[model samples]
Target: MDEKFLRKKSFALPKVNPFIHDLQLSMKDKLQILVMSFTLAPIRLFLIFILLIFAWLIAFISTLGLDIDSKKPVRSWRRLPILLLQPIMRAVFFCMGVIWIEQKGLPASRKEAFIYVIAPHSTFYDAVPCAIIATTVVAKQDLISAPFIGTLLKTLQPVLVVRHDPDSRKKTIQEIHRRASSQNEWPQIIVFPEGTCTNGKALITFKAGAFIPGVPVQPVLIRYPNYLDTFTWTMNGPGGLTLLWYSLCQFYIRFQVEFLPVYTPSDEEIDDPKLYAENVRFLMAQALNVPCTEHTFEDCRLMSQAKSKDLPMEAGLVEFSKLSKKLGIDINEMNEMLDEFALKSRSCKDGLMGIEEFAELLCLPITEPLKELFNLYDRDGSGKLDFREYVIGMSLLSHAAVTEKSIKIAFKVFDRNGDGTVTHDELDHVLKSVFGHDFETRNIYDKIDQENKGRITFDEFYAFVKKRPEYAKLFMTYADLEQDDMPQDKIHNITQRRASHALAGSSILSNVQYSNQGANAILKEKKDE
Candidate 1:
């Protein structure tokens, strides 16, 4: 499948109707009802157990009769039963196959912090674990009565958010802010910005009411690695909720949760909550790779760890010798070739070099075979190459040795305008084509695109090139090298290694892409150290 199409398909999810908001007992209502009914027996048993535990604790405290409202009494003796019951409930839920937890990145606080955004797996079953772990206050419409968990959540004073009106949203924000300001405790308010359940693929459109400005947003990703048939209540086919109830009844699945680091939206960026939600959703999606909807905070955390595990021991190594061998050339020779090309490609100060001289400077004996490739891109008779032409040219040259299609994909991307030539204005565009448009790249462009014309002219391009001659040299030399007789597996290994190295180098280059400001800063910091 085409990569773009695959990406689109992977991210697709069922859309929730806005009209459902008006209905009292909508799908969410029905799901909740089913969950309550199905778990009615267990709920009653658990309630009885809770009552017994509570009664025992109260009786024990009554014997003291020494001002039970005191902090010392509450913290020391009174809190014991609840603390003890927590693990018991967690274990019960785990055994019941109802929920699991996965913690990801380090939290800002190991003990206490206010702003917490919990993303559950979007099912009544999944909600149990999230409610248990995060102490989530469920947001419900005023029409529905609070269910068993809802009553429990209310006791925790988790924010009870109502969603039908603008006035209510504003009031909700105010209440949250007020609660946050007054709280000395760490109960987090959990909101499902996607607003509805999905198939764990595409994320729903986020409602930004809960993400107040200046508040930290901690994303949690959740994943069910087992059979969805036995684990999830939100599956598309028949036996969906039934299977969920059976699974809950039988207790037969495992779950993983990942917690990502807390992210605080900048004051300036917070005005647009939708954008804030989208950014968070995007981060979560990218971390999980299964699709935006499939990801939750827990899934992201687990995925991060999984990816970290997959990283090779030599992932960070830059083996220049191995790279040289793959290119079938001496390292020093290739460097010389690159240096010479870089010098020749330099623009004439007074336009002294004519077209023939320029051609001579650029022409290579090895470029003969590549010329056929270049000619295929020269759709226009213009002697000079454009972004599109150059991209095709490079892609053809690079395709012989690199098996990863991403290299060619990068080439095509650099030719953003679909034009046949690349101009100085498109230099950053080319860089973005290769490296992703990540934070580092954004920083690079913000600094380099000083004129802000959105395109880099030749002068700007030359300045960038001079600062990162290594990349230009590497590409030129790689393009010039002959094919090697390495085994397919070895070639794949080499390609992967090179790609990683390239990404690292590009990151370093991005830091220096603008001027030498960041480079000088680094040096200064090192000196200071």
Candidate 2:
């Protein structure tokens, strides 16, 4: 990865913060420190865990005499230890000499219980102190048993949800309603609606659970300001304990917390929790000045897994099986069939497919589904499919959920000039490259040119995709859409191979051969080129 190439503002630069012009760690220093850091970490990790257990144990022990269901505050004497414990924990972290959390927002007003939603959950520690001040939080049942953090979380009275059980989602929501509506002293409910963590680089989709309560939401954005990426949890990078070790090496880790104004939804929005959640997620992303993505928690989970699987490999070319492995699939079942495409797709005798080889792998008479997959995966528009591109394409196709954001991003891959439109020439070039013939996509072009303008804007392209028949299997969607328009050819017979491959199936695609020049044939012969 060249830091000089196409670096977006969204990706945090690997340099020091101008405000903290201290000498950053060198690679060798980091390795040396990383090894030493963990040796000291277990003690620190254990100390923090004990601090949380004691704080909660004391708070709960003090509260036993009071009416558990009362909304009224406990006697100041009882509250004193609980309040003092939070600050003491903060001081302990500060004394540990590695991290400092700077919280800027005024605590949520106690007048009314509101939903506190946090963003940019980069590490496991992102939600800690805010969770303290915000009172209680909604969490999974497993967190209670999670080492070091579990006892502390239990003190917070986290509303826990079960996984994969019947009525689990409903049960979780009901718990939220109970806690949010309770007259008892359950602190305001805190939730990380993004449902997963990131590197503070992007804000992905938010889960809808937070909005179900239909109450005012207090949105908080958390950013780990770092010269060393203490914020990111990488796939193949050091494991959690090692990352913990690295953070322990930070002379002082600082974070920025911004509390946006409370957003009160209208009755209409309250009734539509999905709409409400999306609106809030969008607002937070805008406030953070990051591009909003349509990826969900599942997308992050799968991508993280795929990244881990490849982290051990060298930087460049990867095997076809490696590509499928990232997508969490075994392609050996289809290897016999894949061999045909691989032979044509591999640009080098090294048996690896680069972008160009993959993009232009198939011949003429391509189907809609395969064409869309190609456009989605070609990435750089250089007519190649590397390991990364291949995984993303196959993941989305296999997952069967195409987000609007993904569609918009993928559509631009075909708009070669970056002019916001896929021009006739652009489509012509792509089709010719893929099929090895200048087959006219006249009908397809006309369909995509919704305004009959001879060009396809992203909106037009998106519309064309949205209108694709959902019934068609992964790669066969478009095949069914234009079966009537396709030319008669023996090579066109491979479109439904996904079904034959059984459980470890994939998008249906076929090899194509153009046997007829036809009147509209724009294909060039070998000599013509």
Candidate 3:
């Protein structure tokens, strides 16, 4: 899709640029890095490392002999060391040039909200909020194995989650629910609902675990209002060491945290955890003054897939979360479909399908009918179909309309002479039946009649329909009109009317084209006047 067109138009959902971050350095910035490498960077690293060891030692003693997997909170005496460790942890950040943290609004008490949902989780520096609050976090289970950071993270008794394990996700949710319902027995938990870092231009979809318990949650926003951004840790951004070097070189990193009001879920939100999470995310994005996007961690996986397939990494960013919700498809299904898409698009330069590739994939030659179908998928008039467009067309225009029964009925309707074969006249009749007019179909018929016998058997017809499933909807509509024993003229009129309605309902491209044509026609009439 054209980025300019996307920016100029108002879309149902905002455009997402959450996963890319490019760091461009100026001469002054380079000089500062050179200067700080010798001066402040060395001192900061030394002091921060020392403070980290002290903090880790404190955490080690505090967590000693305690069951790391315990569902219950630690005893009161065990919590005392954490209180001491918090100041040391704060000092570590201070040494790293986070001299001060500007906080806004009051944080909710444990009784008011057992969960705090943080957003715009863009960098490792975001740990400042965790340190300031001294709350437990939902961390990766693998973090427990990290050298010094592992001991420190364990000290907070974070809810450890294992990615790629369905049972682990279930247990994490169950554990969150348990804590929320424990009535002050457990410490307040903080969740970065995005589950991954972004470039911070937009807020991505929030995971529902924190909101699942139906308890009150305080939405927190983190911002780094700095002139130079060396903090955002995105998949396309600078490496951790590069960001760390840039960050350490800076005299002080500006950080701010704003706590929104504690949100108590209503009955509706309680029942629908996804709704609760979305509402909370929307509120946070509003506070951050950035758009909320449908992008999620799933896009990261898709981006990786795109890269592996030699397509632009952004090609796989099909706003999978939103498409899944609308189309009722899952990531695994999309992944499988992507493999098919890759095969069809292999001849194309950009990993997208043009009209030629579209025809080749369906085993049909280019014709007006094929062009129409390709146009339906070539949304944005870009003359190509991206993965998102392909998926949408497949879901709404093809799969939903193309079924075994419908295909059989349409094929029978096309075989007028009942000789188990369809000739050119019958193919033309089939097109006229659905389109209400003639479409040059010599190419279409020849493509289907691979044997060059001037006739296509039922197998050929079925194969053609299978390749172009979008036609099934129109074919079935025509078959229905034929079953009613309508006159050809009457069938044509009804088919024309119904075709507009069916395409309007099933194809987004249809709406875009119709709206554009309608506006053009209106303008032409005005000029005539």
TM-score to true structure, per model: 0.40, 0.55, 0.78
State which candidate has the highest TM-score: 3
**395: Cα error in model 1, Å:** 43
User: What TM-score, to 2 decimals, does candidate 3 have?
Assistant: 0.78
- Per-candidate Cα lDDT values, in order, are 0.43, 0.54, 0.78
lDDT of 3 by residue, 226-343 (tens): 9999878998779888899889999999999999999999999999999999999888888899988888899899888877877777778877788888778899988877877888
As for model 3, its CA RMSD to the true structure in angstroms is 7.5
By TM-score, the better pick of 1 and 3 is 3
Candidate 1 lDDT trough over 10 residues, lowest sum:
311-320
* Tens-digit per-residue lDDT, 218-251, candidate 1: 7767766653334443322234545445455443
lDDT of 3 at 101: 92
How far residue 442's Cα lies from its native spot in candidate 1, in Å, is 62
Model 2 residue 34 CA deviation in Å: 7.0
lDDT of 2 at 404: 68
